[model samples]
Target: MSIGMSFGLVFGLTLFDNIAMGLPLGMGIGIAIGASLDADAKNKGKTI
Candidate 1:
């Protein structure tokens, strides 16, 4: 999933910037996604 997101981000950003900038942006997005999933996992089956 990270690889796919990275590839998509790279492809999308390639139109505006170089691969260098796209790489970090993709990584940041992937990390954000992972973190959100982790948060959801931690809260699973719990009452708020």
Candidate 2:
């Protein structure tokens, strides 16, 4: 999440010069990715 947010922040700052737009967007995308990874791990019985 942090990584995604930071990346998004940098991207937004560099391109759009916006922080509000980037932070939440990055967080949402990060959450989706985290969920997907968690589900995959659970399916394989690899989750702890």
Candidate 3:
């Protein structure tokens, strides 16, 4: 959702720019967030 939103915003400003900037940025952020959630779930002994 973050990636999509970023892509949409950047694309609205300049077409294709989102692919270069937003994608990697959003993916990095998403990975970080996913990792944190995974860690938290593991701490609570829950499956994601």
Candidate 4:
């Protein structure tokens, strides 16, 4: 999610200084979390 990406970018900038690494890492985590949420929502018969 964009939220995660932004957070990651900020975190990376604050802690490390690697925009490239931070963006992808954050994107991956966001996608995984989003997928999990989506699956859970679908199982619960809800729309996300």
What is candidate 2's local distance difference test score? 0.82
Write the residue-wise lDDT of candidate 1 on 1-48 in tens digits: 486467757765776567766666677777887777778877895433
Error of 1 at 13 (Å): 4.4
Task: Write out the backbone clash pairs for model 3.
Answer: none
Better of 2 and 4 by TM-score: 2
Per-residue lDDT for 14-37 in model 2, tens only? 878898888887887778888888
Q: Which ten residues in a row have the lowest lDDT in candidate 1?
A: 3-12
| Per-residue lDDT of candidate 4, residues 1-48 (tens digit) | 887798779877877888987898788878888999999999999988
Q: How accurate locally is residue 39 in candidate 3, as Cα lDDT from 0 to 100? A: 100
TM, every model: 0.65, 0.78, 0.60, 0.77
Q: For candidate 1, report its TM-score.
A: 0.65
Per-residue lDDT tens digits for candidate 3, residues 1-48, read 475556555654476544566566566666777788899999999988
Extract clashing residue pairs from model 1.
Answer: none
Better of 2 and 3 by TM-score: 2
Number of colliding residue pairs in each model? 0, 0, 0, 0
- Residue pairs with clashing backbones, model 2: none
Mind sharing the TM-score for model 2? 0.78
